[model samples]
Target: MGTLRDLQFALQLKIEELRQRDTLIDELELELDTKDELIRRLQEELDRYRTTVSLPGPSVVSAAASAQIEDKQRAARQTVISEPFIPDAATLAMGSHKSCDKNQKSSRLIKAAFLKNDLLNLNEEEVRAIAACMYHTTINQGCFVLQEGSIGDRAYVLEEGRLDVTKDGQKMRSVEPGDMFGELALLYDCTQTYSVSAQTDSKLWVIDRKSYQTVLMQCGLSHQAHSVELLRGLSFLQSMPEDVIMKLSDHMKECNYTDGSYIIRQGDTGDTFYIISKGQVTVTEKKPGREESIVLSELCERQWFGEKALWGDDIRTVNVIAVGEVTCLIIDRETFKDIIDGLVSDSCEEVQKSNASKIKPDEDPFLVSSTLSDFQIIDTLEVGEFGHIDLVQLKSNIKHIFAMRVLAKKLILHNSQREHIRREGRILMEAYSPFIVRLYKVFWDVEHLYFLTEACLGGDLSDLLKDKGNLDEYCTRFYTACVVEALAFLHCRGVVYRDVKPENVILDEHGYAKLIGSRCMKKVEVGKRTWTFCGTVGYMAPEIILNKGHSISADLWSLGVFVFELLSGGLPFDDCDQMKIPTTTIHGIDRIEFPEIISKDACALIHTLCRSNPLERLGSSRNGAKDIQKHEWFEGFNWDRLCNKTIPPPVIPKVQYPLESSACALYGEGSVKQCMNWDDF
Candidate 1:
C-alpha cells in the first residue's frame, strides 16, 4: 500500500514539470518571431538604399517638380539636428529664402558690402538678390555674435550698434555698419578664427550658408532665364546661341544712373557695349572738330548702344546719356572677341611655325616629318582615360625621344569622343608656342590613333607638388606664368582649355611647364557657348558646372584654383564628401581662410580670376592676358622671357633613367622625309 502511494505522487510531480517545460519553449519561439520580423523590415530598408543617388534624368525637371524636390530636401535636412541655435525666431529660422521678411535697408547695406567684398565677386544684380535673403534680427548688448574656434555656418551684417572682433583675448577691430563678418566660415564651412561680440544692443541681418546658397541658386536660374529673353530681343544680339546669351547675361552688370548722367563720353575709349533695360538714353556723336556733340538717336527700352565694340571697333563712336533714372546692361568688348571669325581657314597645311602660317613643313628645319620605319616604341609612359602616352625614339638617330600618345579607336567610339579626338588633333596642329607641347606627327593604325609629340621628362605638376609641398610665391608665379602663356596662345586661337589643373600641366627637362591632357579642350567660337560638362571635378568653374555657356574665362577661373592649390597645398573648395565639391565651388571662395603664405596681391588676383561673373574676370579686359600679366602680384614678372622661353625655370628634372630592358633611345632633332604617308612607308 505504501509503494503504490509513493509512485502515484512521483508521477504527478513529473507531469507538472513537463507542462512547465512546454510553456517556456513557446515563449522562446515568440521572442524569436518578433526578432525575425524586425530583421525583415530592416532588409527592405537596405534594398531601398541600394538604388543609386544619381538617378538619370531623361528630360529637364519642371520648376514645379523642382520645388517639390526642394521641399523634400528641406524636410530631410531638418532631420539632421545640429546644436540648439533657437536663440531667436530668425537665428534658427527654417524655410525658403522668400519666406523671410527682408529688411530693405539691411539688404542695401549687405549689397554695398558685397560689391566691395573681394571674396564674393558677384555682380550688382546677384549681390542685390543675395542680400535680400539675409534675415533681420536683433541681439542683446552682452551677447556674443560669434564664438571663437567654433564651426560657423552663418554670416552677419550689423545694421545698428557696435561690435568688436577679438582673437586670443585681444581686440582686433571694431565692426561697423554694412560690414559682413563670419563669412569666411559660412562660405568655406571652416572654423571661426576669432570671436565677435556686440558692444551695444545690435540690430543685425544674418543668412545661414544653406539659406544663402539656396537663394543664390534660385536667383541664378531666374536671372539667367530673364536675361536670355532680354538679350534675344536685342537686334545686335538676336543671332547668338541661347546658351551664349545666358553667359553674356551673367557677365552683364546692371548700372543705374540719375537723370542726365553721361553713360559714355564720345572721345572716351569704348570697351563696353550696353543695352538699355529700363529707361531711355540719348545718343550723341561729337564730330572731329566740333566742341559740342550732335544727338544721333533717342534710344528707349530694349535699344542698345556700343554694338560695334564687340566686333572689334575698340572705340565708342557716340556718347550715351541716361534719361530719367536709366538702368543699362553692359558687356565689355574683349569679353567675347571676334566670335564670328573663329572658323577661319588655316588647318595643318598652314603651320610650320617660327614665322607662322606661310612656312611649309618640309622647309622648316625644326619640323619632323617621318614614316613608321623611322621610329621604334620604347615603353609606355602613362595610361590615361582616353589613351596611353608611350616613349618612342627615332631608329636611325636613336636620340629623338618622343611621347607617342596612342588612343584606341574602340575606346574613343565607346566614350563618344570622336569629335573631341579630331578637335585635339586640329588644335595641336595649329598651336605653336613655347609653353605648348609640340605635336610632331599623327599616325593611325587599324584600331588606334597615335599623336607623336614632344616628351616632357619631368612629370606633371601633381608629382612636383608631392615632392615639394606648397610652393612659395616666387615659384608659383613662375610656374603659373608658363600656364598663362599657354592659355594666351590657346585663347587667341579661340580655343578654351577647359581642364586647367596641376595634373594636366607637365614639366620638361629644363623645368619649363607645358599644358597636356588636351581631352577637355574645345573651340568655343567667339560669342558662342558649349554646354558639354567637361573638366576636373574640383577645378571646374561655376559656369561650367551650371552648364551655362562657357568660354576662355572658364580657363582663367581654373587658373585661380591652380594658384590657390599651389600656394596652400590644397584646393580652396575641397570637401571630405566629393559630392559637395561642386556645391562648394558654386558658392565661391568667400569663406575660406587663405593660407598664411599667400600675399594680398595673390589674393586679389585670385579673387579677380575666380569671380562668379566670368566676363568680369581679370583677363576679360580689352588687354586680355596682358591684364593678368600686369597685375601687382606679377609686378616685375618678365612676360617676354616666358613667351620667348628665355626665363630660368625654378626646378630642373632628371631626364635620364634606365630602360625596362638594357637599351633605350634618348633624344635627337632635325629629321625629315619626303613621304608623310604611313601606309606607303
Candidate 2:
C-alpha cells in the first residue's frame, strides 16, 4: 500500500514538469513567429529602396500642378513617423513630386534674382516677361556650362549647385547659386571670357540671346531715349537735334576708367571719342623741350573730349588721364563717321532745296566736294598689270597721307574683270581691318577707278625677302600670324582670298602686314567650294591645280608654301623648268625636302597644311584659324600684340617721307596722270 502511494506522487511530479516544458516551447514558437514577421517587413523595405533608386525623377509640371505636388509631398513627410520609413510606391511618388516642386522653387529663385539684378535694370513687368521666356536646364557634374572664346548665345542664372569658372587654364572664381553668367551675350554678340563647368549637379535658367535682346528692346526704349536726352544736355552735343542724338545714342558704348589711368596719350592715334558721364579727367599737353606735361584743361561730368581726333586727323593732341574713377560714353570712329555722313547728307539736301543754283540736279550732291579735291598726288608707288598706286597727301588743314590705287578701264580686257575690279573697290571700302589696307574713299572717272587707301610706306614682303634672303623664325611667324588673322576675318565674311603670296603682302610703316590684291578674292558661302583655276602656280594647292572644288583650304596651303619659302629661302617644289612645277605640286610633298634649319614643329605644321587632301589641312579643321593659331610652331606667340601691331618687327623698312623716284621704282614704274578734273567723278 506505501509503494503504490509513492509511485502516484512521482507521476504527479512528472506531469507538472511536462506541463512547464510545454509552456516554454509555446513561448519559443511565439518568438520565432515575431522574427519571421520582422524579416518579411525588412525585405519589403529593401525592395522599396531598389524601386526608389531605379525610378526616374518627376517630369516638369505646371505651376498649379506643382503647388498640389508640394502639398502631397508635405503630407507624405508628416506621415513618416507614423509608418515604416521605407520609401514604398506612395513614398516614391511623393519623392519625385518633391523634386518637381524643388525645380519650380529653383526656377522662381532664378526669376527673383533676375528681377533684382542691377545690370539688367528691369522693371517688374519686364522681369516677368524675361522669366517667362527663360527655359530650365540641368547639367550633370563635371560638364561645361560655358567655354572660353565660344560664342555665348545664351545667358545663364544658376539656381542650384556650384560652377567653377576658369580663364586660359587659370581658376578665376566659383559661381554659386543665384549668380548669373554669360550676361554680356544678352547685350551683344560676344564670346564667353571665362569657361564655366559644373562642380555638382546644377539647375539653371537659360535665356538665349535673341529672346533676351527682344525683351531688352521692348523694355529699354525709354532708357535709350533718356540716354539721348542726357547726350543732348552736353554743350558739345547741344547742337545735335533729337533725331541725330537718338541715332548717336544707339552707337555709344559705356566704358569705365580707374583712377590715374591714361585714357588717351598725346602721341597715340585715337579712333574713339568720349563724353564723360561721371568723374573728371585732366587734359595735359606735352610742353616742347620740357619733361613736365602742362595741364591744358580739366573736363568734368557732361563734358566731352577727343572730338578733334575724329576729323580724320587721328592723332591725339593731348594726354587725357582720369582724375578719379570715371565713366564715359564712347563712340568709335566708324559709327561717328556714319553719323556725320547722315548729317552732311541732310544738310546738303536742305541747301540744295533752298538754292537750286548751288547744286546741279544732274550732279550727285554727295560728291559735290570730291575726295580728290582734298588729296594732292605726290608720286607713283607701283605699276601693276591693270593699275597704278600713287602716294598722295590730304590738302586739308590737317595733313594726312594716303595711297591712291588707279585701275584703268582700258587695261581690263574682260567685262567680268572690270566688275571684279569694281567689287575690289567695294570690298576695300567696306572692309575695316588692321591687317588689311584701309580704304578712305572709292570713286571712278571715265578712264580709271580710284581707291584712296591708307598708305603703307614699308613696302612689300617680296622686297623684304629679296633684301634679306631668308627671314628668321620670329619674323616669319609674325608675318604669318598677321596673314592668318586677315584670312580669318575675310573667311568669316565669306571672302576667299585666292591669292596669298609674298608680293601681295605689304608691310606698313610699323612693319605690320597688310593684305592687298583683292582681284582673285571671291565671296562664297561657308562649306561651299569654288572651282576657279586661279592663284600662283607653285603656291596653289593640289585641289586648285587639279580643278577640284577648292575653298579657304587653298589659302592655308599657300600659307604653308609662303612659310617654307620664307624660312628656306627657296620654294619647296621649285624646278629649273616652269612647266615641271605644276607636276611636282600635283604629286604632293613627297618630292619636297625640309632644311635642317626648320624646326620640327614648323615642318609638322607645313606637312599638315600642305596635305594632298584639303580636308586634312590644319586650318581646314572645324576650328579654322584657331587651329593654326594654336599650332605648336606658333606656341608662346603673342597673338594680341600681333593683332594690335604692338610687337616690334624684326626688320623695320627704311622708308623716307615724300618718296623719291628711286624708292617708287622699287615696286614698279607708273605715272600719276591728271586725266580728270577734281569735281568730275
Candidate 3:
C-alpha cells in the first residue's frame, strides 16, 4: 500500500512540472508576437518618411536647398526635444566694424591714433573722406622710395621711416621722421633727377599729386614757396588765371653752382631761364662743343642764361659748363612771365607740334620701333584705274599714286613678271606725259616694292561702265579724247601699251581719262620677238593672236574696243565658246562691230582706231600726237586746256589712321600678274 501511494505522488508532481513548462512556452510565443508587431509598425513609419524625403531616380537636390531642408528637419526635431535657446541682441553687437560706445577709452584712443592734430579740425565726414585718400604703404630696406626718371604721380609723408636721397648716383642726404620727398617731378617742370632709397623698413602716408594739389588749394597756401614750384610744373599756364609766384617770391631761394656741371648745354634749348645762381660756368666754343668739348663763364644769382632762347630763339647760344654743382630755382619761362604780369599764361607745356607730314626726322625712334618697315604707307584714297588706289605721301605732302602689280610678299621673290612690272613703272615715270599715269617714287618695304604716285581719284572706267551701264555722247567723246591723247604720247615714246581695257583706263576727278598698267615692257630677244600675247581678252586685236609682235598701234585697236564696251555696255563680239577654243581664237581685227545708235563722226573715229591693219590705226604715225590733234571729233575742244588742266581731287583723306590696322596687304608686282593671263605664244 505504501509503494502505490509514493508512485501516485510522483505522477502528480510530474504532471504539475509539465503544466509549468506549457505556461513558459505560451509566454515566449506572446513576446515573439509583440516584437513582430513593433517591427512592422517601425517599417511602415520609415516607408512614409522615405516617400517625403528621398529623391526619385537620379535627380539631385542643390546643396543650398538640401541644407535648408535639413535645417527645417533639425528645427522640427528640436521642437520635439522641447528645449530651445535664443541669443539676445547684445551678442550680435560683439562682431562688426563698429566700436562699443561704453568703451570710450578704447574708442578715443583709436580715433586719436588715426586723426593727427591737424585732422581734428575736420568734421567726421570730411575726416573719413580725407582718410580714404590717405593710404599706408610699407617699403623694405634698401628698396627705392621713389625712382628717378619715372613720372611722379604720388607724394609720400613718412610716418615711421628714414630715407637717403641720391642725385644722379651721388648721395645727397638722409632724412628722419616727418621728412617728405619726391614732390619735384610733380611740382616742378623738369624730369626727375634724384632717387630716394629706404634706409629701413618704413611706413608712410601716400597721396597722389592730384589729391595733394587739392589739399594745397584748400589750405589757401599760395603764399608759400612751394606755390611757385607748383606753378612752374603746370603745362597750361594761361588756364591758371591766378599768379601765385609774386606772393611766394621771398621764399624762392637762389641755388649755387660749381665746375664740370652744365649750367645750360649748347643746343639743349628750353623755355626756362636761370639766375646765374652763384659760381662760375664755362661757355662752350661752337666747333669743339658741337663735336667734343665745352667752355666756361662766371655769374651771380641775379644773372641769368638762356633768356633769348625763351623769346622765340630756339637754338642755344652757349653750353655753360658749371665750375661746380649748380643749383637754381629755375622757374619756367611762361611761369616767370605770368608771375611778373600778375596773370596766368594760357600755354600747354607738355606736347609740341609734330612735323609728321612735311618731313621725317633723321632719327625717328617711333618709326624704328614700328612694324611697318617697308614701303612708306601713307593713305588709301578713291583713285583712277583700280577704283581705289594707295597714295604714298612723301616729305612736304608730295603724294604719289601707285598701282602695285603684286601685293603678296611670296610672289616678289619667286614670280617671273617682277622685272616687267618694275620696268613698266619706270617707263611710265620717264614718259612724263599728262595722258599717261605718272610714277613719283619707288621703294621696297615689308618684302614688297611700292610704286607711289598721285591718285586719280575719279575711279576707273571699268567702275564707271559698271555704275553707268552705258556712256552718253558727251561722256564717250570726253573719255575717247583723253585716251587718244594718252595713246599718242605712249606711241611717240616708243612704248606699246598692250593691256588696254576698261580697268586699265582711269578717270580723273574732271572725268578725263588716264592710262594705267602697261604690258609693253616685256624683255624682247634680239630679232626673236616676244609673241606671248597679253592684253584684256576682249580688247586684243587679231594680229595679237597670230604670234606676231604687237606695236603701239595695237593699243589703238584695243582703245576702239574699250570705247565700244563703254557705249554698248557689252563686248561687240563676245562668243565665250569661241574665245575658249584654241582653234577659234580671234584673228581678225576688222571683226569689231559698231552699234546702230553711234553717230557718224564717232563711228568714223572708232573705225580709224579699230582698223584691221596696224598701219591704218589712228595715232599710228611717228607723230601720233599731231594726228590725234587733227581728229575731227576734237574740233570744238580746247586741246591746251584739256592737256594741262588740273582737276580738283574727289576726296581729301582726313583721318588719323591707326598704324597697325592701316598697313595694306603687300601684294607685290609679281603676285598681281600671277592672276593675269600671259598664256598665248
Where does candidate 1 clash, by residue pair?
A: 184-591, 339-526, 399-666, 399-667, 399-668, 400-667, 400-668
How high a TM-score does candidate 1 get? 0.53
User: Which should have the higher TM-score, number 2 or number 3?
Assistant: 2
Q: Write the per-residue lDDT of candidate 2 for residues 1-681, one digit (tens) a residue.
A: 325644554465356446646755764564565455345435544554554555434553576587697665333212000101122345333322322223557657767787665444455656665676677667667767777765555788898889999989899899988888776555433446688988987777888755554454444443455567667876766777665775577557778999999999998988898888889999999978999999999999878888876677788888999998998988888767767566767566457534642332243233335455555656667655456677776554224567888666654532135545554565555566688887666656565667777788898887788778888899999999989998887775667787787877998887789898576676765434555456666787776554334677788888999899888877887666443566688778756778998889989989888988776688764356889999999999999888777889877777677532221211222333332333232
State the lDDT of candidate 3 residue by residue for 15-47, as single tens digits: 644664674576456455545534543454455
Which prediction has the highest lDDT against the true structure? 1
The best candidate in terms of TM-score:
1
Q: List runs of model 2 lying over 4 Å from the truth.
A: 1-370, 414-416, 659-681
Better of 1 and 3 by lDDT: 1
Candidate 1 local lDDT, 282-334, one digit each (tens): 98888989888898889998777787777777766677888898988887775
Off by over 4 Å in 1: 1-251, 254-369, 657-681
Query: In model 3, where do residues sit more than 4 Å from their true spots?
Result: 1-406, 412-415, 519-530, 578-593, 646-681
lDDT of 2: 0.68
Sliding window of 10 residues with minimal summed lDDT for model 3: 77-86
Supply candidate 2's per-residue lDDT for 454.
78
